[model samples]
Target: MLLAVGLAVGLALLLWARRRCPRGAGSWGLVLRHWLARRWLARAAGWQRRRLEQACKDGPRSQELLLLEGAGTPAPDAATFRERHPLTRHSADGTEPPPSPRPPLGLWALLRSCCAASSPLQGSVLYLDVLARAYPEALSPRGTARFSWARGCSLPAAAWPLPSLYCAPEAVGAAPSRAAALYVQLLLALQERALRVLEAGLLSELYDALATLRASWEGLAQDLASGGLSPHLELPQGLRHQLEGLLAPDAARAAELRAECARGWDVIARRLWPRLQVVVVAEPGSEQLYWEALQESACQGLPLYSPFYSAAGVLLGLNLWPEQPEPHYLLCPGWAFCEFLPVEPPGAEGPPDTVPLADVREGQEYELVLTAQAGLSRCRVGEVLTVAGFHYRCPLVGPVRRLSQTLSVRGEGVPEDRFYRSLRRAVAMWPGARLVDYVCAESSLMGASSGACAPHYQVFVELQGVRDLSEAQRYKLDQCLQEDFPVYKSFRLKGSIGPLRLHLVAAGAFRELRDAVGTRGPMARVLRDHRPLHFIQSRVLS
Candidate 1:
């Protein structure tokens, strides 16, 4: 009789709790899901660790030895490394002691070690009909509780919804569209290095890329303005307000930017993925994928999504959450067989050149040494990172800019990242007018009375299309810029500067310039950080 009573009470309690608690939601759900994922992650980490350890122990006999040998560079731990002038605080020698001589890792191997998971083997098709199996009511109204899992993670308003062309609900780039493809092409171009942009052979490719990007933009604009498009996405309320003052046709609600050729969600999804497609169904000779998609995108009028990762990754600095990975890039002190050096003010002997992760404090900057794995040991790759904080013995760093990317005109320093924000402000001022991309150069202006010349800022812009600007528009842009760069303001006030000048380049000018330089997209992107692009002048059809 006692057992029967206990069983009855337990059943009753369970039923009552189910009724009171939200289905598939509440605090319990979050914990349960995380527990499941962490279990898998732990298993994966163990698998990786075991393989790495085996390779370390086996030396020449390891099956992975071939992979290690391909490193083809001087061992970072070799005595020669010790012979180099010592500059690190981490060690009177420099960095962590070289790993047990088992073997060094190549770049690809190092990248793999850093990755959380290998590429998925499964096909890319979303097959919603099939996915609905376990949740037969997934699309039904009652399934609202099914997606409560979304509330678990959040992104800041700035990155919550991307400015992408609308992505398919189930999968990224399942079907090819010019709008979607153009974004990838643009991204590839953005990553290019400056030297590659000036190369002689890559010129035609650059022209083709720029033209396609423009055409795709025009076509996408038309589609967004059309009513009742399912895939079309709108900017979140917060981001919309931020860009409204600069965006044209200025529609805050009701697909306003698309209405004029403008281009997210409460919970952001990775929509820029190309599914299994390199970019929505790779074609023959995708070796030229960037160029191919760009050409197609120029002709298609489809609406597309923005590159979610690129923009979101850059803005990760806005992250306010605790425990989530802070905005950062990694430094492989040993992985690349590299070294890091301290950056000190000029004329004063700097402190210890490099500090170990455990000893590194916040606010100090360091220069990265790369390509030692590529056999260039003495090279300092120009990457500068500021220590934001520490993750245990590992330092969490925020990237400033490559040394080559910083600009100084009359000793008013402007950093690439900061200048980018100022440009966004200028974009906001001319709603309906788009600032596609721009170039800045130091220009010489003759003084009117004294016949003396001075250096001033001359900005050449390639807008979405040619549009006339009123005096107010120009001054408004200029004023917004002064607020953005404090040092620039002081220079202007001190009469050490000439008036700012803006030049509107002709349509297809950038395309012509890109082609003439024969630079690949990746190399071209490198040019973006550099203080100026002399190649850009060839395309200045104005």
Candidate 2:
């Protein structure tokens, strides 16, 4: 019994050691270290290594030195390396001898050597070549060609042929025997190192390139400002001419140069900048110039980076553009409006007492209230003002009192109160039938003969039912909708609303609410008012 217990304890200890050292004892680690050192030592003396050093001195070239070194030539240079190994390289006759196999080296060691090498460019090129060889089938023809070129080989226009040489210990040909074995080993080592260097170097280069491009752009912007390029793009021709004259020495007679710069900027902006969409928020009936500029920017692929409307754009361009909105706050001068009291005049001492009419106050806290006329019939102009301790006009709308309108299905004017009331009534009729969501799709009719308004609205409704309803029941529901909803009736009579449709949601449509709030209750309790519920409701209902 004691002997059995001893055996069990010994087994347990062995298992624990194995778990702690997955490579099996320190022996494997030591072997790997030894192999790495041997490979590096071999590489240092290899022809490929010599060639790589030569290429580094020569500056950037198409040949991949690292690949040549990894392929087997001692200190191999990119210029001498071919696409295929000697064994793989074949003459038209297909009588080439099999290439000698080289021992595999760990990736980590190879990378470390390449990165630590003397030449950054050569190191990068060599590393990329090795990576391609290690995963030969994974790369594309273009990728393979690129790898070869970077290594220093000027490939012939024809398709790559098998290598004519081979490393063999017992061969009866003109091929060198001992040299072949050495070459194969050297090649493998070089390839391993090249891969690591490529990975690290590529990332570094990408970041550096981006930074340089951004700096260039900023410098150009400064030059343009001094040269008199107005930020507003509304500068007079005389001023612009003077600015052009000032920039004549550098930019004159070089329209194409400016265009080239713009193209370069566009390329970086499109390929590297984070978010590209630019959104312009303006009052209804506002000019379209802003939208045009935004569209132009998008076409150039340097999309307008606006946060208010381009949330997806922001997320997609997270790497390149500022994720937040540009001009995060707006400033409006107080003289522009009479709705709010002007605490102080322009250039007044101390912080403007009240607030300048048109000046924007960043980080200022204010309450937003939607006030209606006495009868709650119409939203009065200047009614939606901000209130800190005192009332202030919102900078977003300027001083203009813009009235908001709701469109009926038939393009008739529908009061906001009536629309909300109809929705409330619908919910009341069937306690189980809840009016969950809504949206208005805009349309327009052109030409005077059309007798239609410039803009039209189509309503979409989301309804929740206790149980599933048949098509016939849905028709009845539509009728109920028309009768109870004034907007629906007006739309039907005017042919503004194409048709009435019911979007029925599943019984568990409120599941999302449960998931979000970690509990179940009235959805209204979870989602704040004014949030777009159409999308969420549609998913639940469907």
Candidate 3:
């Protein structure tokens, strides 16, 4: 009897030690482990709800916490990544994917949790979306929510089960999954290593096309100043197609155009164009323009998204965009996910000093760490977000930039979000001009002394419709950039850095970037999705 009892105890310890008997552990390990992880996750959720309830127990208003669990996701501990990088150089055949995010082989199950009953992690659907793509065949949604969860699953390479907001469709490839995956890998490498091709100039034909486009824009900008704006101008068939592709990124013919870019200037002149779409040409206030565009664009289908927006909707009340009034964005509640925090000294780890979420001051930045009912004790997601405001005593925050996106060429470190905002404001100074694509790299400026070169930021911009502007017009933006971000601008003012030069390129520069660094999202993705502006292109803009 004792011998039998000892065997039972040994089995129990083994199951616990093998992370609840995860896949490859034994027969039925995947299914049984997943079940155990789910059970633990439920228990953690209850504990978290209790903690929130306890925190609000003495308040005048009761703290209302909404718990949203994505159907059939592994417990938070089931699967996790140490870091999330942008692009990679992978084989075009799609036979392999960096081995880390390998296509799902078995079920996802949270084997353990560092904070099982300590705190509740919000955004279960967020992780579930990821898992679905990782293991499409295994991790199917148990129930349907009002919104579509796995909308990106239809795409070739970016088939991961992530939400539509988290990915940009322009980067994904078009057909046969492997090729698409390869395209994504190329695009990622291009974006990640943009500096490699910084010195290469635009081919002669490409240069002429840009010059012609600028000439046309010069005429248009002059007309706009004199109050003559056309609703939409007729374009030559070829020019029209290229302009359309640039504006609607996903519309471009991926394979043919990418091959042509390598061929020569003649191919670019034949395949691409000079002109661009005039999105908004007003001095200020583009409300009218946006409304008109929205009216013209049809709502063809209902958008399926993950629970991030749903959770946000729950945290605050659902606020719809004026243009798309049908669907709302929400956050998925429960389960800890990880992101990195930009600490003051930078890159040091171990429990970032965070004020209680209740005590967090608005506009102040803090490292975000989340505890889950899964494997992670506390995970870092490598993002810097700001507390915008409060949502019923909870802080409302939004991501600002990634941890690695800081550029400090002259000891003046400027974050990508900050830089992107300044450039945007600079573009906004002109009416009807569009800032198509941009890349900023550390370039050596002619030094203060002869025979010396100083490192400065060289901002390469591809503006399709905006031509040359007067000193006065450009001067208007200088003040806005300085007043707004001031760090890089201050370096410029102090002569510590050279004037931030903007180099304009022909259309399809960013398209080249998209083709080079393959995107991790679905093809035909939402056009306005967040794109990392730092080094997402490989071709030089001149």
Among all candidates shown, the one with the greatest TM-score: 1
Query: Cα deviation of 119 in candidate 3 (Å)?
Result: 14
| Predictions in order: lDDT | 0.36, 0.30, 0.35
lDDT of 2: 0.30
**lDDT tens readout by residue for model 2, 342-430:** 32323577642222222334334322111111111111121123222211222432211111324333445444434445545654656
Q: State TM-scores per candidate.
A: 0.44, 0.21, 0.41
Candidate 2, run of 10 with poorest lDDT: 309-318
- How far does residue 28 in candidate 3 sit from its true spot (Å)? 33
Alpha-carbon deviation at 332 in model 1, angstroms: 3.6
Off by over 4 Å in 1: 1-83, 86-328, 341-352, 362-365, 386-392, 396-398, 444-452, 520-535, 538-542
Q: What is the lDDT of residue 81 in candidate 1?
A: 42
Candidate 3 residue-wise lDDT, 281-372, digit = tens: 10111112222222232111212121222111012112112123222221112223322243565346664543434555676776554433
Better of 2 and 3 by TM-score: 3
| Model 2 ranges off by over 4 Å | 1-405, 408-410, 415-417, 436-465, 470-491, 494-496, 506-542
Instruction: Tell me the lDDT of model 3 at 80.
Output: 24
lDDT tens digits, residues 1-542, model 1? 99999999867755654554332223333333323333343344455444433433432233122224432343344334435534322111111122112111232333233333211100001111121232232222111100000111211211101111111111211213322323333322221111011101122333343444345644333333332222343334443333222222212322332233332211001122111111111111112333333334332322111111111011111111112223343231223333356777655764545443334558888875433233343355555667776433345566555565455667776665566567668767786776555656555321242135456665667676337767676666557668987778888778787567666777756544433432221222223322235555544554
**Residue range with the least summed lDDT across 10 consecutive positions in model 1:** 141-150
Q: Which model is ahead, 1 or 2, in terms of TM-score? A: 1
